[model samples]
Target: MKVAALLIADPEGPDPCRLVHGAPLLRHAVAGLLASGCADRLVVAVPKSALGDCEVIIRAVPGAGSRCRVLACGADRAESARLALDAAGESADVVLVHDVARPFVPPATVRAVAEAVLAGAEAIVPVLPVTDTVKLVSGGVIESTSDRDRLRVVQTPVGYRPDVLGKVCARGSDPLSDLPGSVRTVAGHPTALRLTTAFDVAVAEALLEEQG
Candidate 1:
């Protein structure tokens, strides 16, 4: 199955170091993708404005020099993915969408999500079971406490059958803040570590160091 690690060379968020500044682990994100080894092809989505920087990055990253393609990433996640799906073509049996900033998206995780998609699951998403007590508050008062067992924090490489993803996007932007069930099913949680803050980056660095 062909796989794409649909990542934004520069994510919209403001933590920086999208590897744009040449952090030691920036290229390591591509290395993570190479671990998949299963993707018949690899592509990196960069802002149309950053092609030159992307070119330099690819050339600098050893094995990635000839393996990745640059596509236009849109303002939103779904749009960026739409561009990727279009590039994957009609024969792409399963598509794996992941974040580059995570850098820790394990190849095993990619393979697991892909396997779930190939297994005829309409949508495959990795989700961590909620570990904290959830509470609902309206204004200043607590309304109700949510059951932890009934909830999950979904993570990516949210995989999908090409058609299913198309259908969800066709409905226009997702209405809910949280991922809705209508879009997919849980594919089992993998090492989906998100990097949004300095602490997160630190955690990711430790995870990478351990992998070494």
Candidate 2:
């Protein structure tokens, strides 16, 4: 099956997706997808202004130069996704959208998502069940406690049938908030945690050292 992956890299951020251990986070994201052999083509999206810098980074990764290309990311995550889908063409049977911030997703998770999509899933999101006590609060007042068992911490490499994804992308709005509610789940690994703060980067660095 023809599958394609889109790794979203915002051009600006408080914790910009830049180099870690001598390689850009986008490169790490690409290597995981490439290693998985799940996506036939990979697209990395950065700000239009950063396309040249992104190209330079892609070229540094040994075999990535051939399998991956850079796209100009849009103003928001939704638009960025749309931009990637457009560049990916309509030939892909399945498309996986990954966050550049979540740079260490295991290849096993990527393959699992692809296989699930092939096995008749329309939209698949890998999730780690919430284990912490959840709460709802407003103005420093506790509203109610949430059911932890019913909560899931969603992770990336979210998969979709290309047609389904294309339709959603066509809306040109925030897919996360605008897409239909139906979703499938696959187990996620801790290593797939997203990098949001400096602490996240530190944790990832430590994890990488252990993996090595």
Candidate 3:
């Protein structure tokens, strides 16, 4: 199965996913994906203005430069996804949309997703079970508590059949809210934590240290 991973990078970086441990979050993600040896193709989607910089960084990676492709992204996630999908072409059997913010996705998780796709699953999303209580609030007023058991916090490297994801992106549908078909889930690891805020980075760093 020819699988491709679409790595989304922050446009205005050096902040959220900045130079953590002297490497940009996007670079770290590329290295992790390459080490997995899962993706036949790795496409780094970055801001149009930042494409050159990202390309430079990707080329610097040992094996990524030859196989990986760099794309100029749009302003938002959906647009960026669309761009990546377009660049992926019709060759890849399955496509994975991964967020660079979640830099430490384990190779096992990536392999699991690929295996699922090869097993005929349409859409596969890795998720970590919700640990804390979740509630629906209205303007600071507590509404009703959501069932935690049914809740699975979604993580990326979300995999889909090339055509399926392409159609979704064509419709500009919000996959998070309106996925076209049935979606399957696999267990996620703590190392896949997304680094959105500074605290998240700290937590990810701690997780990495623990893993070491």
* Candidate 2 regions with alpha-carbon error over 4 angstroms: 11-17, 176-179
The clash tally of candidate 3 reads: 0
What TM-score does each of the candidates earn?
0.81, 0.92, 0.92
Better of 1 and 3 by TM-score: 3
Cα lDDT tens digits, model 2, 98-178, are: 888887899999999999998999988889999899999999999999999889988888898988887888877555434
RMSD of candidate 3 to the true fold?
2.0
lDDT per model vs. reference:
0.63, 0.81, 0.80
**Residue 158 CA error for candidate 2 (Å)?**
0.7
Tens-digit lDDT string for candidate 1 (7-94) = 5544474222364223633465666667767565566666677666665666676677555777767777666766766676666687
Of candidates 3 and 2, the better by lDDT: 2
1 against 3, candidate with superior lDDT: 3
Q: Model 1, residue 97: what's the lDDT?
A: 69
Looking at candidate 3, what is the lDDT of residue 115? 81
Instruction: For candidate 1, list the clashing residue pairs, or say none.
Output: 125-187
Among all windows of 10 consecutive residues in model 3, the one with the lowest summed lDDT is 9-18
